[model samples]
Target: MTVQYKFPDNFWWGSAASATQMEGAAHEGGKGENIWDHWYKREPNRFFDGVGPETTSDFYYRYKEDIQRMKEIGHNSFRFSISWARLIPGGEGEVNQEAVNFYNDVINELLKYDIEPFVNLYHFDMPKEQQDKGGFENRDVVALFAEYAKQCFDLFGDRVKMWFTFNEPIVPVEGGYLYDFHYPNIVDAQKAFQVAYHTMLASALAISHFRKLDIKGQIGIILNLTPSYPRSQHPADLKAAHRADLFFNRSFLDPAVLGEFPTELIELLKEYEHLPAYKEEDLTVIKENTVDILGVNYYQPRRVKAKDHVPNPDSPFMPDWFFDNYEMPGRKMNPYRGWEIYEKGIYDIMINLKNNYGNIPSFISENGMGVQDEHRFLKDGRIEDDYRINFIKGHLTWLHKAIEEGCHTKGYHLWTFMDNWSWMNAYKNRYGFYSVNLETQERTAKKSAYWFKEVAENNGF
Candidate 1:
C-alpha cells in the first residue's frame, strides 16, 4: 500500500468522547443531575425517540474493555471529559469519592495500555444545582467552577498531562441562552453574552491555578472553530462572513489563546446595549493566563451572505442580525444530518491559526462523519462504512497540506470511538469507528475502524 501522506512521528491518533455523551451512569455512582439529565427528565418529548442520557454506551462499567479496544486500534491518545456533576455533585461541595475512583481507574487503565489520556474539565454539563444558582450567568458560580477545576487538577494531573479546561465553551452559551437547544433554555442575547464571558473567565482562572500549582503538563481548551466563508467577493458578503466569524470563532478563540476579547465584538455589543456584565480586573486575568495548547474541533464551515432584507430595529438582538446563512449551491453535504462536508475547512482553520493566531500548537480534537441507520450498511457482522473512511481521508489530506505550509498542526481525533448517545438527538446520527449494539452492548468494528488502525499504526495512509 502506498502511503502518500506520511505524518510526523508521534502524531496523536484516536478519538474524543464526553462524560455525559458516553458514560451512562447518570444517576448512579453518586453522579448528581447535570443540566442534560434534568432537561431530559423534564422534557422527554424534546429528545429524539424520547430517549435520555440515563444509559448511553455504559462506559461507567465497560471502560476497561473500551480502553483495550483503543489499544487494539493503535490509539496513541484519547480525549474524554470529566463530568462536573459527577465529580462534584451540585457543582460545589464535597467531592464524590466514587466518581474520583472511576476517573482514576479510567486514566490508569489508559496509561496501562500506553494510551495517553487527554482529560477535559467541562463539556456543557453544568450541575442542575448550579443552574438554579444562575450557572455561568453569575460571577460567583464562575469561582466555584475554578474550584471544581482545581480539584480535577489535583486529583489526576499527575497522570493526565494533557488537560483541557473546557471543550467548546461557546456551545453552552449558544445552546442554553441564545438558542433553546440546551438546559435553562432561554432566548436572551444579554444573558447569552454574560454566559460566554463567565465561561471564558472560568477557563482563564483554571489555567492560572494550573500554572500556580506547577502542574507538569500542558493545559488548553478545545474550541469548535467553524471558518466563516463569504458567499461572494462582494463587500457586503465579506462583511457578513467577518461578523459571523467574530461572533462564533473569534469570540472564544481570541480570548482563550490571546487572552482578550475582540475590540470589534465589544463595540458591536456596546452599540446594542448588550455588553455582558464584567469587572475591569477580569480582563487582566484573561490576558496573563493564555492556554499552553489548543484543541480545534472542525466539523464544517459556515457560509454567510449579507442579510437580504433591511433590519427591523424592533427585533430582538441576535448574532443573526448581521448576516444570513448562505447555503452554497452544489456544496457537498452529509445527507444523514444535512451538515456540509467541507474538507478544506480544516486546512483553512489551521492556516488561519498560522497567520492570525500565532500558529498555536493544536490538534483536530473532534472530526468524523455520522451516518443515520448505520445498521443498514452492516455486511457480514461489520459495517462497510467506506463513506466515513473517505471523509477522514479527505480532511487528513487537507490537514497534511496545512502542515506542509507551516501550520502548527499536531494530530487528529475522530468525533468518537463508538456509537454513543448524542445530545437531544440521542443516537440518531452514528459517528463512530465502532458500531455499538445497544441491546447487547457488543462493540463491532466498522470498516473505517480497520482503515484507521492501519493509518495510526503507519502514521498515515
Candidate 2:
C-alpha cells in the first residue's frame, strides 16, 4: 500500500541558494570583491581543502541550464539572494548594468518556467568596501542598505513578488562578533549586540521602504529559528532555556514579526549597558514596519541547562554565560554536520508561530542536511542519497502535521539547489539535490532529486 501524505493546495516546493555560494565569476562582469573574496585572499587555508568562492559552481554562466533542471524537477518556486558587491560594485554607488542584466535575465528565466522568484537582498556577503566602513556597525550603513534594497525593488520588484531583507541576519552577529568564524572577526559581546541591533533596524528600514513603494508583493526577513529545550523541568533549566531563546531567536523574531523587542531582552541588555545607541525615531520605524510574511529556516534545536558553574565576574559577557549546552543522551545526530536531528523542532516552531505570532503567512526557507565527503555515497551515475531523502521525509512529516492543525505554513524549501561553496567551510559539506563536479562544473542530480520531483508533483509522498 502506498501511503499518501498530500499537502495543501498551492503549497510552494523548491530550494534556496545565495549569490556568493553559487555564482562564481568573483572578479569578472564588473563584480566588486565581497568579504568572502577579501577573506579568502588573506587566509585561504581557513577554507575547506583550500577551495574558495572564486569559481563556485559557475552558476553565473550556467543558471539557464540550472533553471531548466529546476523546472524538470518540478520546482514551483525558488529562493536566491543578490550579492551587494555584484549589484552596486562598492555597495553604495552606481549600479552595474551588467549585473542588472544578469539578475533580470535570471528572474525572467525562472518566471518563464512558471517558477516564482523569492528574492532576498542580503545573505551575509557584505561588500569589502562596506565592511571597511564598519559593515552593519555604523548607523550610516543602515540607510545605505535601505537604498540598495529600494534599487532592487525598482529594478526587479515587478517580477519578484516575494522580497526578504535579510537571510539569517543573526548569523553575522554570532559568526563575526562572538565567534571567529566570519570576517572582521572580533570576540566582543558589546559589538555583537550593536551589530544585531543595526541589522534588525536595517531590515525594518527596508520593510518601511517596500511598503511605501506600493509594489504588489510581500516583503519579509528570513530567520533561522532553533527552538530551545531545557534539560529538565527544573526551574533553573527552564529559565536558562528561556534566556537562550530570547537571545538567539526572540531578539530578532519579536522585532521583525511583532514589531517590538522583547521586554526581557531589552532589560537584560540595558542592565549590561550593551544596548545599541539608538534614537526614539528608530524604535518607531521598527514598530511600524513589521514584515507581512516570515521565512523560517530550521535545521536543529538548542538543548540547554542551567550554568554548571558560575562564570568569572570579570570575563566578557556572552549568551552562553547564562546557560550551558546539554548534550542529551541517545539524541539523534547528523554526524557530518554535528547537528542534532530533531524533526519535531520544526513542528514546535510552527505551533509557536500559530499560538503566539498570529499564524502569520510563512514557509520553510532553508532546511537540508550537509554531508561531509558525500562523493563516497555516489552509486552508478547518481549519488544514492537515501539519508538525505529520509531527512526531508522526517521533517516533512512534522510540517504536514503542523499544517493539519491550521498552522498557516505555506511551503518547504531545501537549504540549496546544488552543491556549492560555503563560507569558511567552503565545500566541506554538500547539501544539495544536484551534486556539482568542481573540476568539470557539471551538475548531476542525486537520487533524492528524483524522489523530490515526484513529491512536488504529487504535493507529497
Candidate 3:
C-alpha cells in the first residue's frame, strides 16, 4: 500500500530566496555593492562557473511575472530577504527610496495574488561597507542592524506581517569564519563564537524593536538546525556529541527560543577562553526577548564521533577538536549536493522543540536539493527534476508524521522558488521548481512545480 501525507490548515506552500540569490540589478537603483558583489569582483574564480549573483533570476525587473507564476503553483505564502545595502547603500545612513519602492512593489504584488509575504531582513549578504567596519564581529554592527530592522518595519511592516531577523545565523560563523569557503575567511574559533553572539544579540534587539512596533503578524529568527548523533555508546563519543551540539545547534537555538544561552555553552567557551565581549545587561536582554515563531531549515543531521586524532598541540583549535564527522556506512545520500539524506531530521527538530524547548510554532523555512549541472536534465523547455520531487515528498512524509504526532509545525517552504545564484556554488547547483534560462531570459516550470501545485492545493501528496 502506498502512503499518503497531508499538511495542516492554511499551510504556507511556497519557497524562499534571498535578495543576493534572486534579485539582479545589483548595481541599479543606487544600490551599493554587497560582500557578494565585492567577493566575485575580487576573486571570480572562487565561485562555480565564474557566475556571480549580479545576473540572477532578474527578480528585480521580473517580479510581477514571477509572482504570477507563484499563484499558479498555489503558493499561499512566500519568504524573501531584503538587501540591506540596497535599502541603505552605506548600511546605516541614508535610505534609498528606489529600493524601498522596489520592495514595496514586490510585497504588494505577492499580496495581490493573495500570497502572504514573509520578509527576512538579512541573509549573509552583509554590505561591503559594514564588513569593512567589522561586520558582525564588532558590537557596533549589532546596533546598525537594529536600526536597519526598525527602518524596514517602519516602511514595510504594514504590508508584511511576518518578519525574520536573519536566515541561517550559524552558516556565516561556520562557513565564513571557521571554514575557508566564505569571504573574510578566518579560522579563529574565538572569533566564530563572538560573531555568533553578536548575531543573536542583533536578533534579540530586533525582537524587542518589533514589540514596540506592535506588528500584527509573527516575528522570528531562522535557524538551520543540525541534529547531532553519537557514533558509539562510549563516553568519549557521547561527550563529543554533546560538545558538537553545544557549538552548532544550541548556540542559536537556546537564545532565540529559550531566551538564554545554554549553560553548557558557557562552560565550553570558558574552557577555550573564547567568551565573547558583552556588557552587563546583554544577558538580561537575551533572557527577556524571544521570538514569536521558529523558522527551522533542516538540511541534514550531523553524525559525530569521538575525535580519531588527538589534538595537535600546534594546530589552531576549532569546533572539530571535540568531535569528528562520522560518516555512516551505507547511509542514504544526495550525490548531486554531496550531503547526507536524512528525512527524519525534520521530525527530530520538531520533537526537540516540543520536548526541550517550549513548543513554539515553527515551519520548514528552507529545504531542497542543489543539483550541479542540472541543465543536463533539461528536455525541450522543462527540466525533469524527479529527484527534487522525491526529495520534497520524502521530507514532507516525515514532516507530516511529526505534525500528526503533535509537533507545532506550521508550514514547509522549499529552499527556493526558482534557480538563483548561490554563494560560492553560484549557479552550479539549481534548486528551483522553475528553470531559468540565462541566455534568453526564459522561465519554465519543472515537473516538480506542477507536482507541488497539486500538493499545495490538496494540502497533501
User: What residue runs in model 2 are displaced by over 4 Å at the alpha carbon?
Assistant: 1-3
Question: How big is the positional error of residue 287 in model 1, measured in Å on the Cα after superposition?
Answer: 0.1
Worst 10 residues of 2 by lDDT: 1-10
Pairs of residues clashing in candidate 1 = none
Model 1 over residues 302-363: C-alpha lDDT tens digits?
A: 99999998778886688999999999999999999899999999999999999988999999
lDDT of each: 0.94, 0.94, 0.90
| TM-score, one value per model | 0.99, 0.99, 0.98
Residue-level lDDT tens digits of model 2 in 1-461: 14478899999999999999999999989999999999999998899899988999898999999999999998999999999999999898999999999999999999999999999999999999989999999988888999999999999998899999999999999999997899988898988988999998999999988989999999999999999999999999999999999999999999999999999999999998888788899899999999999999999999999999999989878998889999999999999999999999999999999999999999999999999999898779889999999999999999999999999999999988999888888888999999999989999999989999999999988
Error of 2 at 378 (Å): 1.6
Summed over model 1, clashes come to: 0
Name the TM-score of candidate 1: 0.99
Off by over 4 Å in 3: 1-3
Tens digit of per-residue lDDT, candidate 3, span 1-461 = 12277677888899999999999998999999998899899999989889887888899999999999999998999999999999999798999999999999999999999999999999999999999987899988999999999999999999898999999999888887898788877888788888999999999998889889898888999999999989888999899988999988998999999988899879877877888888869988888889999999988889999988899977877889899999999989989888999999888889989998888999999999989888788888678899999999989999998999898999999988988888898788889989888887688999999999999988897
